[model samples]
Target: MKLLVFAHRLELGGTQINAIDLAAFLRDRRGVDVTVHATEGPALELLRARGLPFIPAPDVRLHPSPARIRALRDTVCRVRPDIIQAWDWWQGLEAYCGVHLPEGVPLVITDMMMHLTRAMPRGVPTTFGFEGLRRQAEAAGWSRTALLPPPVDTEANAPGASDGAALRRRLNVGGDAVLLVSVSRLSEYMKSESIKRTIEVVRELGDTLPLTYLIVGDGAAMPRIRETAGRANAALGREAISLAGAMTDPRPAYAAADIVLGMGGSSLRGLAFGKPVVVTGEAGFARLFSPETAEGFIETGMFGHGAGGADNAALSGPIRALARSPDLRTALGAFGREFVVANHGIEVVGDTLLRVCRAAVGYRPGRVALTADAARTAYFYLRERRFRVASRDAVERG
Candidate 1:
């Protein structure tokens, strides 16, 4: 099958990573031809590295104009794909409103942020990344949402030794110092304020314990992150924490770490590396994904939200425990890796997406449906953008 993978951006974040990983799977394992298309994002270097055929697009206008629609139509004409997979809401909106989806070609929208997708394009088949999102969509009268669990490249993230020793050396940390690594986009909104708080934890334990914190990836919150790192190091009078910025490959960081801290895809990637992961998210969601929390974590996509929020456990204790006991790290890491291999490897996820595509192809969308969807989405997009921006400003102020 010829497939066009549409991404919100080509940045170094979970959604982009997930899209590329699955696109790689389709091309390598499913005997499919894949082309990637993206709007703006900083991970252009990573995209070039993938060697996948790509088309760069301008950042999608929430309300796509005729020319924008023509661009998508032209790409579709050129690719003639059997399935067009959109990685998020805006991608789906652009495809649905801005261009003609060929009669037989299926447009599959994967909802990476379930709650944030309050205005998902109607009538387009959507794949939810977590069970929680799937349930919410279904309860809200959405019939097409299917759970597409996260997928990681098992081979790349296979159980490994400390090849990260070289990374540790490069970062100028002592060989014996316990390393805590995070490989996620450093943004306040999506990242659950974990990175900021982790800075505080590192400072709190700076003198008491010999440790190094390495943060990878970049975003809006980076200026603040860099400022905090600078302040923390100056206050400690040493390089206690370092920002590695963004890297195309996070495997080395995972390999070198004593423990990995992240939420969602980043946590899963750490688990894939056979590293112990402390899943962190918004609203007090910070806990290690052990055998006890495995089922719940998997079901909710490693994030606890709203009233179903986290246990609010003190994270340093878990990090300290993992740092102290190599045995525990090994045990927990092994368990986490096993969980990922069984449930989230590309083979499993790719097959599920392919099946959804096949099922979706038979349903043909009409002009009436498409027009209605476009109008509704445009209204929702404008209204939501205003509200979301205001809400974000309010949250930031608080």
Candidate 2:
């Protein structure tokens, strides 16, 4: 089946990564004809590295432009894809404007990896972010919306048994040290505050537990974060924090840590590594874990809210407790890994999305609802225009 995927930019975030992975997986495994339309960014290079076909889209910023919309529509007319899949909010708007597929062309929207309570309305098919928005979408007359969570490669992120000793030594973490690692773009608001707060919490815990904090990823907030880290070190009476910038692969850092702190994609990566994770922010937040499993590790704390210092008081106890007990950490990590595998592993997510795409292309609202698998096959058959069945070939294949 021919499919077109759209994203605002191909940046180094969860949504872009998921889009790339999905396109590659579909092309390689399912032999689905796939084309990616990226609006902006270096993510296109990554797609090209994997030998994926991509097209550049007209930029559509805060307000829509008629020319840009027409350009996108013309691109869609040329491609005539069976389905148009959007990777995030902006992509959804783009898809809505671009594709005009008879009555069947299905437009499927994905939530990427964050939750936005204010952005998504009810009944709109969604995965993680805000429940209220889901309701709003439904009220707005979107016929089919489903929640498909972000996919992660569980095997690549599994923690290694020997990583702890080796990583601690590499980072110069003492035997009594509690290492806190955050993997996120420094410029992102929540990530910056989380790093700052973690440092403060380490200080509040006193010098009893030697602490080393690692900040990963780079962004507009780098200079500010560095200053904050420096101030935190001085306040804590030691160089307790380090910034490693961004690494293409974050699995090693996740595997090496005592605890992983951050939100959205980073937290998901941490879960895949079986590391205890702490998440912040409301957008796409609900997708972090199944409702039953999210109680302890997930907490609601405002970033950069307090005055005197970071609000480590709220998270300090949990951090210390997780550090002290290997059993607790192991159990929590296992739960997170299991949850991600069941819900967000690539194969599962790919299959789910494939079904959604098929439904969008084959949609006949009044007709009977076929099983997701059957719908996919039918959609493919229709797209390929295979009206004639070969009895001999079918029998031979069977």
Candidate 3:
């Protein structure tokens, strides 16, 4: 079957990266012909470099544009896909606004962020990030939804620091310095305040710790984030913090870290690299992904709720602890790597998505379904509350 995929832009966020991976597996393993379209971004650049069949659409937007919509519709009609899938919110909107499909040409959406269900039109089948989202979507009268985590190639991400020395040297980090790496889109909404606070902790730890904070990836917040890092390093009169920016391949950054920190897909990728990850998100939420905390992390969509909710004081413990103890890091890293492989590797989760797509192909949804309203936004508000409570419970019970 021919499959058409849409994404707004490709900036190496796990969501977009996973979309690329999903398209690849569908073409390679599932024997589906796939074409990916995007508004234009670094992901398209990466795709073109890799010789993938990715097309760039001009000026795609959320607020409605007639020309872009017509272009999208024309593209869809030309491809005449058996199934059309949107990997995120804007693309989901584009799928609806862009064209009305012929009967049986199912439209599939992947609501990876959990804040998108309400924005999706009724009867649209969505694949959610976790069971929490699936349950939430079902309660909203959505008849079709599936659960799947982003996939990681565990073998490709296997543990070892073969490139660590070269990367550290290239970044100007001292040979003896301890490295803390976060490979995430450096922005408030994407990372919460975790990345900013982590840098603060590095400054607070001062010259005593001999630590280097390496931030990888980029976003709208890149200028601000880079400025902060630049000022901190200038004030310190050393390369205590380095912004390597977005990499076409972040595996080198992953390989170079003594400890990895970030939330969502970044955290998962860190785990895949066998690096101990401290999970943090939109609040000042932070926590180590230990065996004790793993269940709650998995249950709540693998993101953390900071104790102080954007407080560096609250965020410093997990990073400091991991930095201080290699043994602790080793154990936690092992657990994370094993957990990712066993539960979320590409072969495992990719197959789940393939099955979901196959099932979506043969089914249709009810027209009398729920409205695409504020349901997801409301759920996000409530979910954060639940996550905050869970983080507190874990600490108290510990």
Off by over 4 Å in 2: 58-60, 66-71, 101-105, 113-136, 139-141, 161-170, 174-176, 282-310, 364-398
TM-scores of the candidates in the order shown: 0.88, 0.76, 0.86
lDDT of 3 by residue, 1-398 (tens): 88888765566667777887778877777788888877666777666654557766766333334555576677777788877787755566556556633234577878777454364554667888877767887898777778887788787677773477689888877766779998876654546257788888888785677788998877667788878788788877888888887887888889889888877777888998889988776557777788998888766776755455435765678777877888998999889999999888888888887787778778754443222333443354345442121110011000
Q: Point out the higher-scoring one by TM-score: 1 or 2.
A: 1
Per-residue lDDT of 1-398 in model 2, one digit per residue for the tens?
99888665555656677788878888887889998887666567678887988878765444234544566677677787877776654455445444432234466767643334233222224443233334444565444665555567676667672365665677787776667888776654444566666766766664666668888778777898888788877887887888888766666688778778776557777878887776643222212233454643323211112334424554676677777787877788888888678766878878877877776666544434323323543454456443332111010000
Model 2 error, position 349 (Å): 1.6
Q: What local lDDT does model 3 show for residue 367?
A: 43
Candidate 3: where is the Cα deviation over 4 Å?
Answer: 100-104, 160-162, 188-192, 234-237, 307-310, 366-398
The count of backbone overlaps in candidate 1 is 1
lDDT of each: 0.75, 0.61, 0.71
For all candidates, what are the clash counts? 1, 27, 7
Kindly indicate the candidate among 1 and 2 with the higher lDDT.
Answer: 1
> Model 2: which ten-residue window has the lowest total lDDT?
389-398
Q: Is candidate 2 or candidate 3 better by TM-score?
A: 3
